[model samples]
Target chain A: MLGAPTPVLSIGSGSAYANDRLAPAVAMADSGRVSVMGFDCLAERTMALAQIRRRQDPSAGQDERIGALVPLLRGYLSRGGKVVGNFGAANPDAAYEEFAARLRKVGLLGVRIGVIRGDDVHDLVTRLDCALPELGTTVGALGDRIVSANAYIGAAPIVDCLREDAQIVLGGRLADPSLFVGPICHELGWDLTDWDRVGHATMVGHLLECGVHSTGGNFEDPPYRLVPDPHNLGYPLADVDDGSVVVTKLPGTGGAVDELTMKTQLYYEIHDPARYLTPDVTADFTGVTIEDLGDNRVRLSGARGREWPSHLKVLVGVDQGWKAVGEMSYGGPGCADRARRAEEIVRARLDAFGSDIDDLRVDLQGVGSLFGDRLVGGEPTEVRLRLAVRTPNLEAARAAVHEVELLYFGPAGGGGATGSVVPALGVTPAYVPREQVRLETEVLET
Target chain B: MKLREMAYSRSGDKGDVSNICVFVYDQADYPTLVEQLTADVVREHFGALVQGTVVRYELPNVHGLNFVLDRALGGGVSMTLRVDPHGKAFQSLILDIDLPGGRR
Candidate 1:
């Protein structure tokens, strides 16, 4: 007996931001209309960092913010509002155990928590006989340097867990949109093979996946399309039934939801409008249309879908050596000139030291750093000199940082000299046959 | 007039590629945007920041043109030494393009 027209709310969007999203989640839950609340906390770099944490501590790797979020949602859980999230970045089992303990501590007992694992294919990645389409290299060529490899699993496992009466679902390295799609599929009982319905649902998931983005958080026309009470911005919600969705937010909350806002989010991070790939289906947004339904609500429809791809996209994190960046600001007249001199001095120092830096860059931040060789008009009163270097050896990276620190003593008006040397992790995109990876789901009770 | 007077833009990045979408507020401005905003014009506008090819995709339903710049962001956010590694600020550059209509 699933809710036919399920109202899904997106609570948290990015990776562990400081804002208190729990308050809005509580508000949406108190309405007694939301059947599911999904949190998307995993990003490309965030997953890579989670993998590093997992290597350091076996029990860790989940989003730390989940520890604080679930306890606050106990009231909602008691009200029968379900939760699905990818806060279990690299360790779903460990995250589920920790979440269950927190739930019991808060006196919210007997809550069934479902954990979805087996997305990680670090060991099996090297054995795959396939070449990365992006880099044109075989998986075997990557060899032992691959630290973490996880496929973007879809919504089927999540729907499966919800069918078993699990109040909460946790997954690791799953596609972000699937966090929203799972609840939709479970409530609607839409077949995975139904490309049209799946695609429409996926479009809804994408609109709500970023939480506040669709609700005017990062809207383009700012002052014209004002978002009232933006500091306390409200998250987005989708009321869905069949294949249609109405995108809206909690009533009387901050942020505006309209056609412009929805349009911007629709094209966000999307390369091709016709072939937006996900584990569930190949969503086609070309024919999609949006209509303002009034009062911060818009109707989205006509999203078609094709068959799912034969291979799953896997993100692999590899150690790419060490990188160091140092910066110092110069103020008052002739600041750009002073910054240029500082850069020259640092480059001369590195050159004199016989440094074997792989990629070295020096730029005046206030002048022409972002545009590269393209110079902007006029001079600035203040400029910051940024020098960055990548080296195979940590000591060399530190030496490069030291060179920028030396700028304070040599160059005039040089201040705020600071820098950091950290191990660099580069992401390599790969593909693996869908059958090569297995998705496992387990229900745990408190 | 500047392009911002007629359109709004948003930029995003994937690997080393950066895509900027310029959406016209008025439907009538779509043809003008398509005519004035070509791949060559975008390449010249971005200059050296984009070392590779620039391809444009038009979405008539939304009155939008998406410009994909390759080899941008130096080498993507994670590896690039750029201050704006995500290329989030690049939208303003595209919006600053001059228009023939003069402040529509």
Candidate 2:
């Protein structure tokens, strides 16, 4: 806990949904109340896709959102609002170079940028002594098919970068919540061993990490329609000091930040409430409490934490051949029956070709496609038949599309046929000793 | 009354596991939620979608119950061919469950 509290604002949440977040973030930064702004743009497979992009072109591994977001944040950067994020994805060095160049082009030169590295442990994965606990397989089994492997690093290096007076910090594959936690630790001077404070701050990071989710983005039960100005939903912010954090959004922005929204975001993607594992510490959210302070403000407290883990969690992406999908709709009377016949015909034709399909699924769109064969009864005037398949080779994957196309020739009424095939990237989790990975920071100036 | 009338929910996925959180509107209904919404009930409610075990974590202070369903979401967000790849829609699915004796 610090003598004075510091406010950290979260700009972007998920990778794909981050672009729309800049407006609200800039709006908040303009108020001059936030000390630091953090952006969490990397998901489990984001680095895998980024690595593929880098393989194609040596300088293409950075999160593309940075290019658009930097210009929008130029005013904030000039006004002394610090920034930190995992938008570096698979290549922090390349991302830093690109960002510096973009800044210079916009005449916002001389901004100090820090790049944190060493999250990529692709070379050490096979030699590591640990194994993937979930799959019951050793790292050696992943072989040469592994494209990218990164350990989820904590906030120490990020704090070190901040201490060096870096205006912007770019990181590769750091833990999502650490983006926010790093700033809090740097500002409040909280020790890593302060379990209670760290735990309380981690909850604040988790709530703000998803941006609008804590501010009414994907909130459905209360029905988003009731949320004020749902179209212009605000991003989340945390006013943290003395281990106590109050969550709220920009004052005039459109969104609700009550207890319901906070609770929903608290449990999002967490496996165990008692033991929420991370590189920094094993946070226990079970003892946590939330108080609705009215308006859009909620207060969170009582989050307890234990010691940090000996091993860091890593995500490994392996090339898994190709996947193909095709969809067509059947309408008018007996649409469901016609859709079923179309599926059977496509399955029989694909089987006749003897294609080496690893997995094949035929689903009736308006029926039970999402739940798989659990159809609730109702007569539908139209039904779309969707065929999806995965195969070890592109030839087999393409054969699935060919079979679905034949439906137009024989099926009674099959229209709107669309298909696509792309290489699949499969992800698996592994654990590696913390000592095996070294985190280093580099400062670059425009 | 439907569970949606009493509670609100939010869900997300990590690998093949999907977690859905149900937060009752009133703190007084926390006990009823804990007793009625069990692992077995959620596993049965999800049916074939959940191939493995279902674990429920209770947070009495927040009046929230988190249901972690294993082997759900077809495969996961990146690998799944389903329309709702991240299983974000599952929150509404679970919230639609029927509750006995109406509001607490």
Candidate 3:
């Protein structure tokens, strides 16, 4: 309940996804506009990939930028600026360890760091045999092939941590918007169960969670929609009041925060504007109104909320094995024809592997790699023939791409040949009872 | 005319689903967009690329239309071997849709 009479909470965006540029985040921290900054460092597939890394090395799966980030965050933490992020990725304890060590190294003693756990429901989903709707099977069906299962958690643990005076909070699979929602609610005295207030906070969180997306990172086009300083686009910050918020970026930073930018991001990944399902609340953004305040500021309001969903959505990571990709360029007058011939040769060669290769695709880059025949245009002067394959066996994946390398001797005029294989992991969604997840937040003073 | 003449779009992915939102640059064209860009229309425009259902949601207040295409990506983002896994290019591909009454 620590809020001024006016009660405006200013929170800024730190990082949008794993490996997001640190310079912009540093800029936001030093700008002095926000007292709290939320960083969303995980995407749908990010956790699965992080899990793969963890499987290989016990201490390697957390966000890799913490070492570089901690020194950068020193000034902000000294000024009493709070930070929250899903930097835990697949490892919350490792993230906490790194944060503690780094903060102590920087002489920032007495900083309270909160570590949230229990989002990992791999064992829970397995025991419950949760149904994986996308995979058309149960978690038990996947057996040991299922690598990890992490629930998309809400702002509840974050609020709990903040209530205990955590200067920094990090967790695994914290829903992107919840990173901001917790801070806003915690700072403004908004109750976690207050649906409308949480919804309003969620709307503001959604706006800033994507970092530069709310500003202008992905809004630029050559002629139709253009923003200034796209290369240096700044992350968005929100001035949140009770029912409304004004989202804007730092001064003179690239990108705009006008009505169009706000509208596009508001519904960017949202399927239904009226009912955006998040762990915190069933937020309704349909009634939201956007007003351009000029100079990269947009005021948005009218977000309502209903009761939270009883079931929580969990991302189950399945061991998809390996994916191999090989490409070769064919140029000149008969490039498309030569590329097709190259594809035929590669296909016939790949047929020997048979069922070892699960999914096989051969496409000409400029011809029909994307959109298929829907948008395949005229004959191109040059096109790259790309052969992609997926398999449970890495040897088969490597051999499949090795066939592409053999193309140098098979097809005429095939130049600049390349081949590579990488471990692949697929993530699917499953619903579990919310009560099944028991979040534990431990606050540590450095 | 193509929808590109009157609107802008962005596509995002959640697992195998792709949601592409289109907002008209000019508010007057919103109704026409709603009338012409139905789920069926967008499905047909995408053809075999979209193996599942197409759902269109209207944003009247913001003059926008959101199209959620199910099983649109070749599996999920990391699983899909397609050059554009997340359908990041779908935004541009959607602009190529034919809108009969769009302003040139």
Candidate 4:
């Protein structure tokens, strides 16, 4: 028999599948078994891509999938299910405007939705320029080149939406873990001082953030890989109460949801067992335990958390000078050895030409030794050599790579350097972390 | 040793969980450092600082080692604390592990 209906139910959508994604959550709400339904569409790596893409194309449109999900989210709200989604891309304000327009189109004007701003913490980029006594580094030197900055807003405003009687909550850039955090604030009416419960929810949020990852999508088990469902994988849901909660999924789903999946996801981002850092709070990933309750239900309790760090871990990319790389393929009897020999020849030639190479990075893709760091024991018949060079001089970086073909025509190893040689040089931005970032929240009039 | 990259994979729910794989990165002499810093080695090294049984697994497919420290983090680990609830202790603890490669 099912226990008490959870006041909050989270649905983690792995990716922005289309506007119609709201249908699944709608069905759950129709059953009258849940209080709030959330959809997570952001990908960890996708955020990086969005940062790079936005730099080049300032007006890039919303991702096709995210665009489609907006209206469907509006429809879910019209149907009486309190919907919340993370459709905010690099431009959350833009996404919010578009979503607001969509709500207006459906005759559901003035929906009174909430958008958690202030997480964009980009301004902190400037503060990190000068080094503080505690941090011992300059701002611009540390996180000055942050491509994108975001603060992980907590659940205060999200709970505000529930109290405001808003039907939906749309966030532009909330941390994936906060999706779960927002709901707990609505449930327990706990203040930020409730460290233990907040810690428990943070752990739950982290485990549940990746959706299926906690259910078997990325488990290390060779025999039971990625849970069960390959195509129709179900999103994870948490029925939280007090200091614990149960993780489960819709019945008959393909993926596997057991103790193993949860453990793996927990280990994914954890460093020390005592502290796990996020904008919301710092949790100890090592402090968690999983109890598999058979038939797709697992209970989580005793997960504790500590106060958030004074400074968030900022990933700022700055001008690390310039780097250019090109690739050449080689095959045949000594193909593996030949590829290495060709790279050496190019380096030799570049050095002979007075190349002031600050750093020369060579990647023998199949060889597995790209950064000259890791070396693989076995060698394949063919090898692809991706050579990169970093220097203050762009021409030198370019000239050093331009010699790839010279080796192909030179006596060292000519046959292996085949196919088109393309230039791959891009400037790397330095990364810096500031002391603190401002996190603000706003309740939107839908 | 520096904690270079920490990657994770999940299986089931909260309770009755199987294993949490943590890959530790050392300096150039990874294997030698790993041998000394194996879960058992770590458990032995931090015996006074920590408690419970910790197991180490070798991942040949990837160029790293995995540590399965059972009930060692004072509580049932994640069950006792949230992984993403922000805090300084987690990072400090990671920084506290004296490594064969070097000390933080």
Candidate 5:
């Protein structure tokens, strides 16, 4: 028999990204307010890099914090707290094994671990020659340059694993919100197909998925927007009930979780509010309402949902050769002009490589790099000229980097020159039928 | 008055697509936000920073508008050579847009 719905399901966010600081996660896990913690460890940028790391070492693509995190979460885990994370970035087996070993080391026996596979449809997309909408080409056209393709799986596997009493659940490229939705649905006894309830669950998941972003990580601006104690910002947690959720941070934590912070996060990564598409459902957040409950607590509701998308999004990684970045500072009188001259020199020098370099640009940092011509600041006493290049030709890439280091000879007062060359893994999106990705879930006791 | 004086914004990305949600600090100013901060105004302000379409969606419940800009991040992180590949700085840039009049 299914368990009755939880009157209120409390879940907290652990890590927002792959390299996110673990201190906040430690605090969130230690708090007794949440029964479940979700870690969204993979991002659009991290996924591509994870693929490269896995390619170099067969067992390297999992979340690096698994060892440290396991110990930090020991107290909560021992007390029966559950975890759901996309910890298996490019390799699920590696993540699963790490969790098993870490749990054993922490003296936590009989912990059930769930492994969700089949998100890695690298071969399936290649066979189907999936059309890469971003690249405007098919998978077969790229050939071996295509390194990896992982679909953003939904909460089904997580819910399945939880049903089997999995204490920790992990998978590769599990949609960020799904990491939380899975646990919420499982504990709340909410049906996967119930559009409205799932939407509410997704709303809660969205609120907690970004960790401090929901609290105020990127929400500060001097003289305009400010939060209390910005340094000690606490990770966000949710108090989810039937149709509504209250988003707040731990007491005494830096940052505010008021109506403004919650609203910003509500539509943070969402594109179309009316059709916010996830692997599980087409969520509609247009009518979502936010009520400030004071004391760093805000209630959110009114998120609706329709049917899920017909196809799942697959993030296909392309081995885009190497990226070279070179920078040098020009200071004192006429710094802007000198920086412009430096750019001209680099552009002219890089032209020798011709079309071998896919893309190249040079920008003056203090003057116009970020906003282009839109927001031009005053003539700075010093400006840094940054030249970046993407090229299939490794030697050309290295040559571009070397040229920047040689800038000391050309521009007057051009000191602090720095250059770097690294493999650039580009990602493009492709859609495949949901049935094509046959996701499998395995729950086993450690 | 400047939009930044009465409003705040946050930008996010999905590949080449960028979304910025702007909300008025006061609920009473929601109408002015809708009237002055149209998609066209934002597109023009962004200029070449955005190469594709700019579509705006209103969130009356939250007193905000979400603007989705296509081809906004200069081909995104890996492929683009832009400094801020994610256009994260766009949020600060958008707030510079002028409001209809001074409320002070």
Candidate 6:
């Protein structure tokens, strides 16, 4: 069965909680005779969300969905398929254990699983903390206010999983694109030394990393026209053979996998195509080409890449403290003028009373208030003025409200009260690349 | 360490800043595959690729490297329309490298 190579299938989601969003794609893989299933999840936001959930419900700790997502994998496994994913966020070991337990309960005994680690590249943050040569002029602007850092993990560890005969592999905090790239190299028997093809696979992985983004779900220019269903969009699949790859989606699904969509995705989250960075290598995206093969399919080939350095970047978040904001609207002739005057009064009041308004910004909506009157862009006439302040002191931040009431009596004050004050959240610390977190690769008897 | 491609865009008025995430991996025979695999080496490698003014930092605690390739991609300080969009795949192409274990 493994000889013909059951079309290798993979799925990627934008968030950790997108299990439902990723289900359709997984289902399609099963129906299309896919042998292995993998998920991409290096989203920092997802980690933050998982942290919140862990704190609230200790039982629902890390790997919150192993029981949920693994069962689907087991169902496929029952049909002689395999599953793998980077469901491990801040804690991959914990996720792996949970997955193993889930499999044990389902009677999938002796399921050899592997966990890939050693990608926390936070040491660079210290160097960056002292002096960052890459940021140039902007380095001084940020000062030492960076919260977290993390190194982008690559596909080498995934290959380790393949070597161990693992039916399933889990990763903690790996780059989303790496999930797709690893399997392609494994299936095609492509050598890691083959930088060109590996880079091409990485390109394909990047295109579909955000799940439906490449399939025209989030596209903008009268965009991809992703058919059948856009809201409940289906993820894409890269059916490859020889030296080429065809991007497509399942039948009776929603999404466009054509040249335009691929092109749009290619340019989405990229900064420099010439030196596209990852945990693997510096890819040359400009050297690649794309072709639309009709039927929601696009063929990608002719890509090149280079060797990576010896470290990973770590992203970390720190406790930045709390903030609160309140907005009030003003309409009429001098509404814009009134908003500005009110803001000045509030600032003066807070400043006079010993309030900790470390970061204070009041935005005038209707009247286009540019950064120093260089009004190049913005809504010409804003009707609402949003006044936001970030302070360590909660009482002081609340006391600033006095300034809002005074605005009504000012020159532009035409409002009584329209909106309520919204409290900003206490920022949490998110840490990035921190030491090479080690994981021993072992073939579990299960 | 050369400019393989240039993707610029005027997405918003948020200046022409490109956030580069360099990937560095360990050699196949390396004993401890730490964050070092994706740090300084990756940054310096790509810093050369863009052929632009560059700044770099070593995230020791994170075991990775970061580089800020400045004025590299094309974009306008104003206008939300990113006249040039490099897309994420472009970055993947340039940073593409081989795996340690070769092909499975």
i-RMSD per candidate, Å: 1.5, 1.6, 0.9, 15.3, 0.9, 13.0
lDDT of 3 by residue, A74-122 (tens): 9999999999999999999999999999998999999999999999999
TM-score of 4: 0.67
Instruction: State the local distance difference test value for candidate 2.
Output: 0.79
* Candidate 5 Cα misplacement greater than 4 A, ranges: A1-6, B100-104
Ranking by TM-score: 3, 5, 2, 1, 4, 6
Model 6 error, position A133 (Å)? 5.9
Models sorted by DockQ, best on top: 3, 5, 2, 1, 4, 6
DockQ of 1: 0.59
lDDT tens readout by residue for model 6, A230-275: 7666677666554566777767667677765676566444555666
Chain A of candidate 5 compared with the true chain A, TM-score:
0.97
Give candidate 6's root-mean-square deviation (CA, Å): 12.6
Per-prediction DockQ, in order? 0.59, 0.67, 0.83, 0.08, 0.83, 0.03
Q: What docking class should model 1 receive?
A: medium
The residue ranges of model 4 lying beyond 4 angstroms of the native Cα positions read: A1-48, A57-64, A72-75, A83-86, A102-108, A128-137, A141-149, A166-173, A220-227, A285-287, A321-325, A345-359, A370-376, A389-436, B1-104
How well is each residue in A149-225 modelled by candidate 2, as lDDT tens digits?
Answer: 88899888888898888988998887878887788878887887887777776887898788888888887433423
Query: Whole-model Cα lDDT per candidate?
Result: 0.79, 0.79, 0.90, 0.53, 0.91, 0.54
Tens digit of per-residue lDDT, candidate 1, span A394-417: 888998888888887867889999
TM-scores of all predicted structures: 0.93, 0.94, 0.98, 0.67, 0.97, 0.66
Error of 5 at A316 (Å): 0.6
Between candidates 2 and 4, name the one with more favorable TM-score: 2
RMSD, candidate 4, Å: 10.5
- After superposing all C-alphas onto the true structure, candidate 3 shows an RMSD in angstroms of 1.9
Q: Say which docking band candidate 6 falls in.
A: incorrect
